[model samples]
Target: MTIKLMQGNEAIGMGAIAAGCRFYAGYPITPSTEVAEILSRELPKLGGKFIQMEDEIASMAAIIGARVGGLKSMTATSGPGFSLMQENLGYAAMAEIPCVIVNVQRLGPSTGQPTAASQGDVMQARWGTHGDHPMIALTPVTVRQSFDLTVKAFNLSEKFRTPVILLTDEIIGHMREPVKLPAFETIHPYEQVVADTPESYKAFRNEPGDVPPMAPFGRGYRYHITGLFHDEVGFPTQRLDEIDPWLERVNHKFDRHLDEIIMVESDFQEGAKTAIVTYGATARSARHALKIARQRGLKVSMLTLLTIWPFPETQVESLGDQVDRIIVPEMNLGQLALEVERMVGRRKVKRVNRANGEMVTPQMILDAIEG
Candidate 1:
């Protein structure tokens, strides 16, 4: 393993490369531009292709095309750019294209704050697309985890045949830390293929894993992919049967594999009366508060969610039943807190929020624990 000091954006580029990503298409956006910059410089040297699209929508569309062309593809962006990519992002999902989307989140409702850290996009990343679709999103706290999780994100996307979001913030994207890089041979990439014959191809047919292996165009798999609801053959259909199966399969891919697909970290969760819950950067502060509370002889633990979606409802509800109170600290105004309350029921979940382009510190969480 090679230990190198790297920024999170650089780490994502390197991680994608390590994951055998050969196609990158993205328009530059702040706090995330470095990912596009580094990938543009490196991909060509490694016999890969990089395209700087005219805009985020076209960039997303182009990457989907590359994926259909039998290449592992990805795109990166911040708020405004991400907003533009939403339509095609929904397209990728509807067609069940496997790719990674890195959203290095900035404060936003509409370019709310650029070059600042915010987790406000947490809900958007999960539900930003128009309809009901299952999405796999991974949140990384440290720069090293950013590298590791990006690779995992790609793997999950490919394995599930859906677009996976690497939900990160400007803090982690710009943070510098030492990451231990595994050997290229040690890293395994997701599989892809091009159909040898055009006759025997069905783009949306579900295999045992609820994902159909893709064969890129020009390799003889002359198929059409569209954003509209489609049948198993990837052709648009208004039939309820087609729509039902299509939506069911999409949800099945994640639901059947939830235990395998979702990752969560629970610290001192057993028999705790007071618990602090968090994810992303805010979890760091929650961890610190947990440590201090333990030192002061308080029965406080933390459940830091590594997998934000699929909600981890089973685990959260169990923790809630054991704990007298659960305090959720996030960078937004009770976004995750709402989910926690929904899962565990009201009257037990409290929230500590901050939304002014600032980090939630340990004292903030400690006060919640003490309260």
Candidate 2:
């Protein structure tokens, strides 16, 4: 491995290539445009394809089509663009098409800020897609993790036959740092093709397992692809017998494979009275505050989330039970804090929030810990 100074967005773009992503389709949007820009320049050099779609909606649609064509596919967008892609994002989930969506979040209700940093999209990444579906959302704290997790996003998407969201923000996307990336040939992305003959293969079969391998569209593995609830053969179905089985399998798949889906890092004192729980860019400040609290002889711990969706509920609950108070720092008006409160009860949680275009400094978190 070689070390190089690279921006996080660039690292994500490079990581996708290393992860065997052969197709990228995106429309430029602030804070995240760099990912698309880098991939546009790099994909062609590596015998891959990159397309600039007319809009974010088309970009999302194109990647799914590309993935169905047997090429690992991805797209990158920010705030408004992400909103435009939601319908298609949900379609990818319903159709069980494995693709990666890199969302470099900016502050937004509706195009609120273009270059600003925010973690406001936390709920949107999980519930924005309109249906009851299991989603995997990974957030990276640094440039290196950005690269590492982008590859992980692709792997998880392929492994579970679902769309995976790489939830990032302006801070991590634009931050510059040195990272050691693995060789492309040495990296592995979960393959999603069936070995059996087409006649015997059922595209959406749930008989033997929750996930059935996806056969590439052009490899004589022709099957219907739609957002509607479908039968094992890929035809839209209304029968409760067919629908219930698909629902059970898709929803329980993540639960059965929690070991691989939930990822977190803990830095806790043996007997800490306070804890900082955070993810995405806010973890940077949380880490600094954790160090300061320890230096001041205060017992403290921190839980940094790498996977944001599927919520790591048990871990957070256990952490809440161990500490007298749980501090959550975010760049929004307490979006994730609402989830934490539900898990641990309102009495044990403290929130530090920032809605303006600025990073939450360590002092803000330190103050919360002391309070």
Candidate 3:
């Protein structure tokens, strides 16, 4: 292991390489451009490929195609760029292509602030892509966790045969801190193994396990790939029998194994009546408030969400039972608070939100806790 001062965006680039990503294709966007910059310089050193696509749409398409051709692939973009990739992002989900997308979020309705930080993309990461599909999104509070979760994002994407989003904000994306990264060779990424012969391989087989092994396009296993609802053999099918099974498998795959997908950090005080629940960069502020609250004899706990999508409903629900009140701090105007409110209740959930490209500070949360 090597200890080094690393920025969060830099950590993501290093993590992608460590995760066995051999292909990166993206157009530059603020707070996220560093990921592409680092990868462009590093990928070629390891015999990997990096391409500067004309736009985010092509960038998303390129990575999917690279992954289809047997290389682990990824792309990075901000909000507007992320918007452009949504259609293709949906395609990757529908086609069951495993790829990682890094969205280093900026304040945005449409390029609202290029260099400003915001967690406004929380909902977009889950529902940005159209149609019903399983999505995995991981957020990190520290530089080290940024690297760690980027690797986790790739692993989950490959393991579940779905697109995984590394949802970050300008704060974590640009912030620098000391991180200890393991040797590249020591970091083992999950590889999808194809056990069946080409003739026996069914790309979208709805079998006992929801996740079927994927065979790359150029491999002897030449199977169809499309965005349409398809049969086990990957052919576009209109039959309810075929479509229903695919939908059931794809949608419920994450649900069936949610124990493995959902990750959270719980710092609980035995008699705590109030809890601070947050994710991404806001988690840093939440943690600080938690520390100060505890020091001042305010019995408060904190739940930091790492996996944002799939919501971690079970954990939040249980937290609701234990705590009298839940304070949710976010850079957005209470985006994630809605889910927390759903699990807990609006009455029990206190929201501290800011969407002006400014972070919800620890004092804001401390005030909420005291109030």
Per-residue alpha-carbon lDDT of candidate 1 for residues 121-173, written as tens digits (9 for 90 to 100): 88888888888888878888888888888888888888877898998888889
User: Residues 74-114, candidate 2, lDDT per residue (tens digit)?
Assistant: 99999898899999999998899999999999988788889
* Residue-pair clashes, model 1: 1
Candidate 3 wrongly placed segments (more than 4 Å):
none
**RMSD values, in order shown:** 1.8, 1.1, 0.9
Pitting candidate 1 against candidate 3, the one with the higher lDDT is 3
Ordered from best to worst lDDT, the candidate numbers read 3, 2, 1
Best-to-worst ranking by TM-score: 3, 2, 1
The better-scoring model by TM-score among 1 and 3 is 3
Q: lDDT score of model 3?
A: 0.93
- Across 1-371, the per-residue lDDT of candidate 3 in tens digits comes to 77889999999999999999999999999989999999999999999999999999999999999999999999999999999999999999999999999999999889899999999999999999888888999999999998889999999999999999999999999999989998878888999988899999998999645699899887688788888888898889999999888888888888778888899999888999999898999998888888888899889989999999989999999999999999999999888999999999899999999999998899999999999
TM-score of each: 0.95, 0.98, 0.98
Local accuracy by lDDT, each model: 0.85, 0.90, 0.93
Q: Tell me which residue pairs clash in candidate 3.
A: none
Q: After best superposition, candidate 1 residue 309: deviation in angstroms?
A: 2.2
User: Which segments of model 1 are wrong by more than 4 Å?
Assistant: 192-198, 206-209
Better of 1 and 2 by lDDT: 2
For candidate 2, give the lDDT of residue 205.
Answer: 87
